[model samples]
Target: MPNKHLFFLLLLTAMALALPSYYFDSNSIRFIFFIGVVAIWRYLWALQHFIRALFFLKVKFKRLRQQEQAIGEIADPKHIFILVTSFRIETDTSILVYKSAIAEAIRLKQPVTIIASIVEPSDERLIKQIFYNSAPPLRVSLKLVRIKGSGKRDGLAVGFRAISNSQVDLESAVVAVVDGDSVLTENCIKNCYRFFSINPKLGALTTNESCELTQSSRTLAIYRRWYNLRFAQRHEFMCSVALSNRVLTLTGRMSMFRGDIVGSSEFIDRIEFDYIDHWRLGRFRFLTGDDKSSWFQILKDGWQMLYVPDVKVLTIEQPPHNNFIKGATLLMVRWFGNMLRANTCARQLPRVVMGSYVWWLLRDQLISIWTSLFGLVLAIMGGLYYGETIFYAFAFWILLTRYLLSALLSTLHGHFSLSWPILLYFSQIYGSMVKIYVLSHMYRQVWTRQKTTLKDSGNRLEHFIRTFGSNIALLGSASIFLTVVAFIAGVLTTYDIQAFISYYFS
Candidate 1:
């Protein structure tokens, strides 16, 4: 089906649905049509991604495997540089991660350098012990660099500099940035290295991720499931975007990059000192999300980013706190904060520069912050005016759609659980709220895993203003969105909003 044909078909279908609502006099019918249309589009979004990702997973991987050189048969494999940042990571997880990386390097039969960036002397010793115990061949070496506990960005900069300065061939070599807690599975590199080998314009690529939770607590268990579901969804989203030769983020967990781009001075500078010029906040320095900087640089320079759905990176899970609600809220604050900050910058790119679909994806992130909560607010308002039956009807509809959505996600990971539906709703509603809160306070940064924050001076008046402004903005936006939702639910009229706006602005 061509895009032109598909677009016309969809437009006609929408027109047909709207005719009934135009004829019907009841708000009940209109609200039903609204909900139905929203659900249809949501499923359509999922359906397209499922098809795109499936094509890549089934078709692309098979074709690449058939055409590309075998793992050990390449004529001249590039020098592999694995940069692992292990700040405050558990010792056991560190050993497992480094040991697996060393094994992969040794297996490659190519010259490899592993740079371990850490602030702890013990971790340095531990990594060294693993290196020596493996007794890697002469082709393998270790470069230990210590940082001042600044952040992952600084650690990565130091490691990247080491690689950039080496005698290796910058054009053909490869760099892998791995978190301390993420372990490489067997053949992870073998599966991904071929993509960069085949595609000359490929600047970087990221692999699928899976979390390994060792704790037995029930709260941690639920969180583990939530993390797994997120990764599953991430796999599909990354694959779909990669079809356009671009990914939103290269992923900080573990992503491979072309050696030349990774070593470039401009690339390093972008990641190390990335900042956004805000109209209100002046210059907002990035406290995290180095991966976004890297992705944006590649996108701007006309390079490709591939998502290797077959290669999986295992991350050792660590809960931010014992209480799930508090931990989840804080984690969302950081995640959405990073997203909104980077997204705001990306949306400013011209359509010609970013492409239409890619730019739409960034713009949709802001629109979704409001639309996600619309149905919920509508349901509550409908119940207040109509009856309990209206709320029950909406509740049933929500549960069905969420469950079906979660079940469809199994196509990515081939696993489904009863908890996914519940978590999906939790994520949608809670995540939207977090995005709203973080939108107004994106300048304030914090790291979830490490207790890190943006360096700032202590000033009571300035801090109070910042806090007050965020609250006012959040409340104002919520009030406006709720008002709109209420109007759609027929609880409020156009005159009501017009009068309020006139009074407020007047």
Candidate 2:
């Protein structure tokens, strides 16, 4: 069905169910009212984030247009450094990224230095060939830095050190870090540079990301495509966060920084040896999440970070495993692990330093995992006891609210498809579960890209207890809370808890 038709159908269906009380008794009305309250709370929470996102987006584009109109007034950087890092990268992806970088360089019409950080000599040769074959208009200068196949952090450190040693004018140069699989948009540099020109305090800026799905299976493709769309939605939240002079992560896929900042020894040190002092796991080394380390360093230095929503990078996303569930699980484990590790110390920063809103976001990370599950579990239990009315109402509420949100987001982000509402539910429920597991096993870190595993120190039994204990406690607590709520609801509706329980369970 067409999006327009489907949307209207959803709207009409929602309207049909809007007056459920008219069709049911007073008890049913109360139950529906309770569900409505919860739905409203969730909607308002999402609306707050969305509204801030829309506002920042408006501001970003306005600034972009203004900068474009007065292009001659804005001083373009003297040198633009494109740092490309690769580790056992596919030849096709490496070629695409380098080609895009060269094209972008030509468009910028600046003397561009391309630094290729590679562990495999084969990749270095391939990249060198791409640059060497580039047209004269590109004006591409190539530097190949070889590193041990250690990790992304090490590769980035090597590149940063080389940039520091180069003769580029740091004050007027911009360094962009692009992942091996990421292709830069033509206007990425132009749009990002304007921010640096406008604000000298802007330390770094990350662009919006769109993904190219590489999964062969149709099911996996659908899942990956929707996942990418949701990822775009996340950028909206980041935009709002960036307005407070803090972005949760400066994505390594493609983020630009001032040359001086990237060249500094402090920045290099952070990228090279970023670690968290875990109470249980001792000083755990950061095996991944180079992006988080960079963001933290910038944040710690009081540098302003901004999100360029208009500027986007096309990232090639390959499923880690053939099975969608397995792939998503692996990806989430790595991602949430990275986030949880960084967040441990991030929450310790002074409120003035991190901003109160950011602090709240950090706190929300801990609560939201369980809260997301709470609603679904409530609906399920309500269905079991009270029949399908509660379940149907809950589903209707999710569909109507998420579809409306998807429509609004699609208008802004352009990838919101009919599948988005379904994906939203999956992300909320399954994604929350993944986050909960990762939160418990924060010490687990793995590089899904290169199949590298970093083990947390401890015996299997100790690790199992530490990891699963939190989950058990969380479930037990939620069960007790829900039981109490159910008892109260039973009394309010049926007026006899014992009879209500017997009617359902018996």
| Candidate 2, residue 285: lDDT | 83
Q: Compared with the true structure, what per-residue lDDT tens digits does model 2 show for residues 334-373?
A: 8888888888878888788777888888888776776677
Local distance difference test values of all predictions, in order? 0.81, 0.79
lDDT for residue 455 in candidate 1, whole number 0-100: 73
Top model by TM-score, which number? 1
- lDDT digits (tens) for residues 1-506 of candidate 1: 24744564465456445443332344667455346555666677778888887887788766766666564346344788889998888888999999998998888767889999898999988989999999999999999999988888898888888888999997878888999889999978766776776778788999889988865666987888899888878988888887777789988788999899989999999888999987756676898888888888887787878887778899987878778888898888888887888878888777777677688889877887877787787778887886665565566566667767776788777887667877989899989988888888878888878889997664888778777877888788888888777777788998887998999997
TM-score of each: 0.90, 0.87
Alpha-carbon runs more than 4 Å astray in model 2: 7-33, 36-38, 68-74, 135-139, 456-506
Task: Identify the leading candidate in terms of lDDT.
Answer: 1
Task: Give Cα distance to truth, residue 453, candidate 2, Å.
Answer: 1.2
